[model samples]
Target: MTVKIAVLVSGRGSNLQAIIDSIERGYIKDAAVNLVISNKADAYALERARKHGINAVFLDPGRYDRSGYDRDILKLLNNYDVDLLLLAGYFRILGSEIIDAYRDRILNIHPSLLPAFKGLHAQRQAFEYGVKVAGCTVHYVDEGLDSGPIILQSCVQVLPDDTEETLTGRILEQEHIIYPEAVRLFAEGKLKVEGRKVRSLD
Candidate 1:
């Protein structure tokens, strides 16, 4: 069965483009991004989706309260029969309604290694804190802030002359690679969640 995916975005969808490219190139097999929803009408991610002939929608945040907005998102997921939800640069914290409905089915990619530098501007947090190593993590989305089971991670070295921008750019490169790989694993039924760990079934 082809896995139907719905992506939520609020910024430039670099990761979204990566997933689309992966699907088109057959790196992610038997999966299609059927829907792309953005809270900002001007989000370039929506444009990326439309270019690929995917169903892209801009759900105005002002039209509804937090809970109501999430409820509407749930309605869209049900209407489109989305099997997996991916958050790509989406800015808002999801409420319980959607989180409970989707639970383990939702995936999010963070700039830092996770369990550290969570919340916003993770790359900057790592850079200013002077960490020697910085990377990206793909994990399941839970109620807590970026606290979810780990799936895949790729590390990048923080060079001696690297600034926050340079480090962020390198970390994002890894995010593009591992995020799609994680999605492919989920599509192939190669991922199993147990306790705080995500076991890859080879």
Candidate 2:
């Protein structure tokens, strides 16, 4: 059975593109992108989805309250029978209703190692903190901000002369690689969450 996915994005949707590429190349087996949702009307992610012949929808944040916005998203997910929700550079912090509805089925990709830079400016936070190692994390989306059960992580060494832009570029390369891997694992029923950790069954 193919696992249907609905990817949420706000910006360029590079990670979304990675997943689409993987599925097209048969790297992510038995998986299909059912829909792409964006809160911003001008998001390039929607254009990317259209290029791939996928269903794309925009839910403007200004139209409703937080709960109402979540309700609308949930309604769309239900209407499509979407099995998994993936957040790739999605700017909005989802409300409790969506989290409760999806539970362990929703995933998000974060720029930092997480538990370190949870909200924003993660690459800048790493550079300012002078961390030698910084990377990306793909995890289940919980009620807390980037505080979900970790699914997968890949670290990149921070060079002494690295600026925020350089560090972000390095991390984004790994993000493109690992986000699709994590989603493929979920699609194959190879991921299990035990406590705060996620394990691959195979």
Candidate 3:
């Protein structure tokens, strides 16, 4: 069974591209990205989706209240028959309606080893805090702020001469790596969430 994926993005979408490339290269078999949705009209992710012949949509948040906007998103997810929802650089928190609907089916990649620097500018926060190691996490998305079951994580060492930008870039590279691996695991039914832990049957 081919897994149909819908990705939510609010930025340049490097991780989105990584997922696409993995599917194309058969690194992730029996899966396809059917839709890419962005809240911002000018998000480069939309353009990336278009270039790949994927359905790209821009939902104007200003046109609806928070619940209403999420309702529209849920509608779209239904319309696309999305099997998995992936959040890659998406800025907004998901409402309970979608959360309850998707539950463990929703996946999010955050820029820090979560349960630490969450919310925003996580890489900068880690750098400022003088952490010796920083990394990214792929986890199930719950209603809380990055408080979810972790699926995969990879750490990057903080060098003495590393700037925030450099650290962020390295963390993002790891994001691109593990996010696709997590998606592949999900597609192949290799992941199981039990309470706060995600187990890999593979």
Candidate 4:
């Protein structure tokens, strides 16, 4: 069975492109991206999807409140029959409506190692806070903020001369790598979450 995926993204969607590339290159096999949805009409991710001949659309949030917005998203997910929801740089905090609807089926990638410097500007937070190690985390999406069980992580050492941009550049590289890895694991039924810990089954 091919795993059907729907990507929720905002902004450039570099991770979205990575997943697409991974699927196309057979790094992540037996999975298809059914739809790509973005809140911003001008998001380049939509363009990336259309360029690949994949279905892509922009959902307007002005027409609905938080739960209503989630309802709209759920409608699309059901419409596409998406098996997995992948969030890539989506800025909005999801409500219980969406979280409960998708539950453990939704995954999100955070820029920091998680449980630290969550939310926006995570790279900047790590840089300004002068952390020696900064990396990315792939985790399940919970109602709480980046409090989900971590599936995979790749670390990038923060050099003494590293600025936010340089550090982010490195972390984004790791993001491209691990995001697909997590998706592939999920597709292969190799991921099990228990008590805030994600176990990888071979």
Candidate 1 lDDT over residue span 1-202, tens digit each: 9999999999999999999999999999999999999999999999999999999999999999888999999999999999999999999999888889898899999999988899999999999999999999999999999998989988899999999999999999999999999999999999999989999995
TM-score of each prediction: 0.99, 0.98, 0.99, 0.98
Q: Which ten residues in a row have the lowest lDDT in candidate 4?
A: 94-103
Candidate 4 wrong stretches, greater than 4 Å: none
Q: How do the residues 122-190 of candidate 2 rate in per-residue lDDT, one tens digit apiece? A: 989989999999999999998888999998899999998899999999999999999999988999999
Q: Give candidate 4's root-mean-square deviation (CA, Å).
A: 0.8
Alpha-carbon local distance difference test for all models: 0.96, 0.93, 0.96, 0.93
* Model 4 clash tally, residue pairs: 0
Tens-digit lDDT string for candidate 4 (74-180)? 89999999999999999888888878888889999999998889989999999999899999999999988888989998899999888889999999999999999
Alpha-carbon deviation at 34 in model 2, angstroms: 1.1
Q: What is the alpha-carbon lDDT for the whole of candidate 3? A: 0.96
| lDDT per residue (tens digit) for residues 1-202 in model 3 | 8999999999899999999999999999999999999999999999999999999999999999999999999999999999999999999999999999998999999999988999899999999999999999999999899998999999999999999999999999999999999999999999999999999998
| Clash-forming residue pairs, model 2 | none
